[model samples]
Target: MATHASAEKRNRQRIKRTARNRAAKSELRTTLKKARNSVKTSAQDASTATVTAQSQLDRAASRGVIPKERASRLKARLAKSLHKATAKLAAAS
Candidate 1:
């Protein structure tokens, strides 16, 4: 659908960028899911998962696969959940 030479180049760039972005986002999703699941398993696991989630979120934002604000929100939620899980575990003993 690109008529001009520049437009054709842009279209190719877009295709390549799309593939790269999709892979980045998919990796972020997988990491986040693992983090959340770990929270339900144990306090140590939750702490590890939260740290991993924050790292992935920062990477996603840095790479432009996700917005900074969105990444911050996810990091906050993960931290909150981790705190709650840790507290619950502590209270149990």
Candidate 2:
């Protein structure tokens, strides 16, 4: 479909970038899900998962896969959930 040589080059670049971005986004989602699941399991696991998910989110934001504020908001929510889970565990014990 690309007529010009420059257009063909750009098309190739777009395809590669799409794959890379998709992989990064998928990784981010997986990390986030793990963090959320860990919250329901245990505080220690939740803490580790939160850190990993936060790091992945930051990387995704820096790479332009997600917006900075969006990443920050998600991180905040994760932290809040982690805190609540930990507090509930502490109160129980």
Residue 37 of model 2 has an lDDT of 96
Best candidate according to lDDT:
2
Tens-digit lDDT track for model 2 on 7-84? 999999999999999999998998899999999897888998999999999999999999999999999999999999
Residue lDDT tens for model 1, 1-93: 889999999999999999999999898899899999999887787777789889989988998899999999999999999889889988998
Best by TM-score: 2
Steric collisions counted per model: 0, 0
Error of 2 at 76 (Å): 0.4
Query: lDDT of all predictions, in order shown?
Result: 0.91, 0.95
Question: Relative to the unseen true structure, what is the C-alpha lDDT of residue 23 in candidate 1, on a scale of 0 to 100?
Answer: 94
Pairs that collide in candidate 2 are: none
lDDT of 2 at 29: 94
Name the runs in model 2 displaced over 4 angstroms: none
